[model samples]
Target: MAGTAPGAITVALVDDYDVVVVGVATMLEPYRDRVVVAELDTNEPVKDVVDIALYDSFAQPESDHHEVKTLIDNPHARRVVMYTANFHPDLVAMAQDLGVDGYLSKALNARELVEALESVHAGERVISTPPSKTFANSGDWPGRSEGLTHRESEILALITQGKSNAEVVALTYLKPNTVKSYIRGLYRKIDVESRTQAVLWGVRHGFLPDHRRIDHWRGGP
Candidate 1:
């Protein structure tokens, strides 16, 4: 990868959902001078040579998945960072073993997130502290407008992907009962009463993963 401009670290935000990347992009807008979002890719490869490729693990597989390795091997991304709410010790270790430059928590505020990216760009391996259960979620997800919390939205997204309760437990590392509770909560918020109804509502409300990329910053042509 080529060098970035002085005083700015170029970034490629990666996720499977358009809303996920867009939310992170919006959060970084105020700090554009320090972090230039060079690309916003949804289920697409990072085509530009950027200082950092920040992979948001929203409604997607965790760092243990092959997706993380793909980002690490991408010649276009000088460094790859895992930006996720999951900080399981095993997952962090897996990401480190996969050669991720950083493992950041989603609880970080905008300023802290930018600083962490800067640290990674400076060739440091960074890992954030686990967030308290009371910490508010930082970025957006698919069903936030309809009152779904990040976890609830994730459950719905996985459900839309046809994951059973047990599968959700495995993928999210959540207890089976917790997954059931989230599903129940999301069902009420979305005005659905059954799994079929929730899936229908999720499909209509953008729960599916996207398949394109935004090469420019913030809608530039």
Candidate 2:
């Protein structure tokens, strides 16, 4: 991360919500000399064009990524830097697969954020999640959905081990609705759209526990 530092990396701030837009804009104000920031409208394409588009997640866990996808799909933003809290490795992987130039954290201070921007602008693929954090319930769960809550991770393990929602409920002694909620949360956290994907992701991330012995699991998702 070494550069002579330009006047500023021209950046267009894009976030669906107003408070998020304002909050990020204010955060960048202190770095005014390092980065020139301009806001983008929620509906219209970017009016104040820039060198890169900094899209904020505004602490949406891994939720509401469709908005980020929309930003990536449109051609208005030259380089799409995900200024987000969705730092799960799996989620970050999906973002990279979606062709996000840089994956950053909303929790970062102004200096770290600015450095990330500069690195990203210099043609780097920056996905900042701790690659080692997995679904295993180690004591040091860092943040939301990145490693998942203990129960959610355990449920994800069972789901990957081929447990149905009902079976998971029984295994965890949680109600069916609770199991379903955890399932949905797991899916959203890992950014998987379906059972098969979630299973594969679990396997890929070593998230399996032990499989429950059932004659046969009922019903398919």
Best by lDDT: 1
Q: Which stretches of candidate 2 lie over 4 Å from their true place?
A: 1-6, 41-44, 59-64, 130-221
Tens digits of lDDT, candidate 2, 99-133: 88988865566777788898888899776654333
Error of 2 at 182 (Å): 13
Candidate lDDT scores, in order, read 0.81, 0.61
For each candidate in turn, the TM-score is 0.88, 0.52
Identify the leading candidate in terms of TM-score: 1
- lDDT score for candidate 2 against the true structure: 0.61
Which parts of model 1 have CA positions greater than 4 angstroms off?
A: 1-5, 40-46, 133-137, 212-221
